[model samples]
Target: MKLELLASFFLLTTCFTAFSQEKQDTAVADKGLIKVSVMYPYAEGKTFNMEYYVTKHMPMVAAFLGANLVKYTIEKGLASGIPNQPLPFMAIGTFYVKSLSDYQAAIAPHGDAIRADFQNYTNIIPIILVSEVVN
Candidate 1:
């Protein structure tokens, strides 16, 4: 009887340990790794040439930012919550980077030239964010 009790207790502890690990994995999956993002929001009556952005600007970004840039995504804001109203933003650009320091180190060297090309695309100053992905 004592041996059986010991065996059952061991099994119960093992099950709880496995359950704890599964819960931890789920939490991690719910909240992803840390990352950096650079977002460009639009303004009213702003002159933004999407053609130039896609052709000339993005290529320059990829070339200048270098390999530390994990990835990049481009979004065009369609409509806001209010019905029959224009969206607050026209376009938002996101860049997935390793960290703030990594981005600064990689792109600082080319900052001058990279910034200089801004006028060729849009007039609005971009909103940059260095943050983690928690979704």
Candidate 2:
């Protein structure tokens, strides 16, 4: 009986330790910097042109900013609850940066280039939001 109890206790402790370690790993994985660019297009254009910008201009901007572009997703607003008319297409660009200052410095040189590129594309100014990953 004593041996069985000891074995159960050891197993329980091992399982608990494993669970704790997994939680810590998850926490660490969730801690990172994310920069999001919410891209909106001008109302008077065809979706084809917006798609072209996403395919062509996005890559150039990402490269110029020196950010690791993780993913780019296109989403449409259904029930977003925002005041403005729902954007036809919203391009979300996710980038990971080491720190806020690092992110700012990396994209600082590309400001003029970004503006120039935007002028060539659409008049709709994109909203950029930078956030730190917090779980």
Candidate 3:
């Protein structure tokens, strides 16, 4: 049941992101900007320490990425589209970079350290997506 819910959430999120960007300018899409999205699916009894995520984890990651990262956004899920439905995801963290290679290289050295810090923030495993920003 948990796996099914997670799969459904991912499918919906991917469709939404793709469709939303469909009408965007192709010229803008020419920029080789890469977006790295980390999403945490919501589940009963899951725990997420938002305070630690925002104040500590994110900042540490940003520092590690340094100049490779152009910008980033953090979102906390509230309610789903259907009334009284559970939020599909607990939170999302997205970071943009001019070059995927640069971002990869930047994070490579600190990858282990980064993963190790997850325990302080949330118990749920994150879903990571790497894609070219089509506007």
Candidate 4:
């Protein structure tokens, strides 16, 4: 009878431990990574200074973001998939961050400066997308 009680207690402790671990894992997964994409739609007669964007503007933004920024990518929009078609976007910039709230807090103070810097790079107003990177 004592041996059976000991085994049952062990099983109950193991189940509780597994349940606790599963809950912790779920909490962490809920706070997944985030991606911020800034895309410039292609437009006739619009101007984009790729040099200023890459060399000056992006670096400045990255500085503002500081440690919250996991990494970033810049893509020059090439020809569309269909032949003889104009590109959908002039350029695309993406930033991967661990936490959306952290990214937001990092950039909140520099919002105005960031927006004001746009004229130095592109005439087209950029479209911004914030999404969770679920993979």
Please name the candidate that would achieve the greatest TM-score relative to the true structure: 3
Between prediction 1 and prediction 2, which has the larger lDDT?
Answer: 1
lDDT digits (tens) for residues 102-124 of candidate 2: 65776788889877877665666
- TM-score of candidate 2 relative to the true fold: 0.55
TM-score list, all predictions: 0.66, 0.55, 0.75, 0.74
Q: Which tens-of-lDDT digit does each residue in 21-55 have in candidate 4?
A: 99888556545668899999999999899999999
Give residue 18's lDDT in candidate 4 (0 to 100). Answer: 100
What TM-score does prediction 1 earn?
Answer: 0.66
Q: Please identify model 2 stretches exceeding 4 Å from their true place.
A: 1-30, 41-48, 67-85
Tens digits of per-residue lDDT for model 3, 1-135:
999999999999999888777745543654578889999999999999988999999989989888878888899999898998899999999998888888899999999999999999999999999998664
Better of 1 and 4 by TM-score: 4
Superposed by TM-score, candidate 2 places the C-alpha of residue 2 at a distance from the truth, in angstroms, of: 43
- Residues 5-123 of candidate 1 have per-residue lDDT tens digits of 99999999999999999988865653543454445665677767778877787777877667667677677677777997767666766666555676778778888887899888888
lDDT of each: 0.72, 0.63, 0.89, 0.89
User: What C-alpha root-mean-square deviation, in Å, does candidate 1 show against the real structure?
Assistant: 9.9
Worst 10 residues of 4 by lDDT: 24-33
